[model samples]
Target chain A: MQDIYILFQVAGVGIIVAIIHTVLKQMGKEDIAHWATLIGFIIVLVIVIDYLSRLFNQIKSVFILQMIL
Target chain B: MGSILQLFVIIMVAAMLVIIVREQNESISFLLVLLLGIFVFLFVLNQVEQLFNLFQSIVSKFDVSLLHLDTMIKVIGVAYLTEFISQLLKDAQLNSVAVKVEIVGKLFILLLALPIFISVLETLMSFIPQ
Candidate 1:
């Protein structure tokens, strides 16, 4: 349940960022728009990295991959 | 099955979102696809565990050595992990790197199976008439 919510949060951030970027660029603020997109990507990436770590741990436990990790 | 249906719906929605984002930001679209791939794998992980457990139980009933069973499992795991990573790399446009990774995986699997190969050879050698 919680996982689904986090996914939605990331998706929402992406959509919002895309909107903000397009709006800013329309106003002739290309640099600001680029920064906004980059920040959005970083935020989503942070969340994704956390999820990926959890996934890796789960894989380690499931596969008993003591040596590889 | 119901959960699979739910996953399908989620994936469809995510695909739509990715398509929408493609025109705006290509990298973000790629990220979305990558995230969806991970999500799908996570969703099916429990099934994978169940399958492994079933295989273990079935193999235990046989007279095969535990070492062989363990090696078999490890080889399967390595193959799967390698395929997954290589596919991701290919999706990221790293074709040459993906090919190298696959070669590495094949070599690792071969190494893991060496003990089994030795056992087979010894058994065959013992069949010769003294």
Candidate 2:
């Protein structure tokens, strides 16, 4: 339910970032275009990482696995 | 049933989106895929947690020890988490790392199963000994 929204959000971010990168490149700001992509990557990574941690916590709480990572 | 259909639709849409975005930004495309994978896993994970809670209650009804069930749950958890990570690495094109992650997961599962193994061995020994 809520999870699907995050999926769309990521896809939207990716598409938006792609558009920005290309538009920036066409404007001759190749460096800024690169930075945009990098920043987009980091933003996506942060979102994914936040969820990843939540997932780990959920697993820990549910299974209570002693050898959990 | 409905959720499965929903998941299928989501995956299909996400796949097409990946194809659409792949041309412009490979990294973002990959990120989109990664996020989708995690979402799908988490969706199923919620169901699994519910199922496990049910199992816990059912097991409590029996007079048997819970140690085995606890081990089984741990093994299942370990297997799922590691497989999810390895698959993510595979998606990222790190075959070697994926394989290592899988192997380590199997090793951890084996380590967790040692008590069950010992119990089985003891039973066999009881049957064969003088």
Candidate 3:
């Protein structure tokens, strides 16, 4: 459920970043476009890291019972 | 069914977007594909949970020792987690790192199965002349 939302958010970010990069490049601001893309990548990476941490926690909780025995 | 349809739609959209972006930015396209892969796995996670619950119920009715069952579950979990991580690594083009991760996973699984192996060896030894 929440995962679906996160996926959409990531896709949105990717598309928006790509658009910004193209627009900035067309305007002869290649450096700023590059920076925008990098920032977008970092933001997406942060979101993915958050999701991965949640997944790891879930996995730990699920296997904790098995670990005790 | 509905969720699967939704996932299919999302993947289709993401794939088209990746193709469009690939001309301009290769890494971002790759990242989009990676994210889609993760989402697809998560979409099936509910089924995995149900399967685990079924295993629990079935195992509970048997006379098997809880220790053995625990070890079995742990081994399966280890396999699953290792596969997931290894696939992610492969997606990132870290092939060697992915192989290392798989080797480590196999080692951990082997360690987990050691108790069962020892018990089987003991049972076999009991039938020996020595």
**Clashing pairs counted in every model:** 0, 0, 0
What lDDT score is found at residue B112 in candidate 1?
Answer: 81
Worst 10 residues of 3 chain A by lDDT: A60-69
What is candidate 2's local distance difference test score?
Answer: 0.84
Model 3 pairs in collision: none
Model 1, TM vs. native: 0.84
What shift in Å separates residue B70 of candidate 3 from its native position after superposition?
1.7
The lDDT for every candidate, in the order shown, is: 0.80, 0.84, 0.76
Q: Candidate 3 falls in which docking quality class? A: acceptable
- Evaluated on chain B only, what are the TM-scores of all the candidate structures, in order? 0.83, 0.88, 0.77
Residue runs of model 3 more than 4 Å from their true location after superposition: A2-5, A26-28, A64-69, B1-6, B62-67
lDDT string for model 3 (A16-58, tens) is: 8889999999999999999999999998888776766666666
Q: DockQ winner among the candidates?
A: 2
lDDT of 2 by residue, B49-116 (tens): 88988888888877556668988888888988898889888987999999999999999999999999
DockQ, each predicted model: 0.47, 0.66, 0.40
Instruction: Identify the superior model by lDDT, candidate 2 or candidate 3.
Output: 2
The number of the candidate with the highest lDDT is 2
Model 2 stretches with alpha carbons more than 4 Å out: B65-67
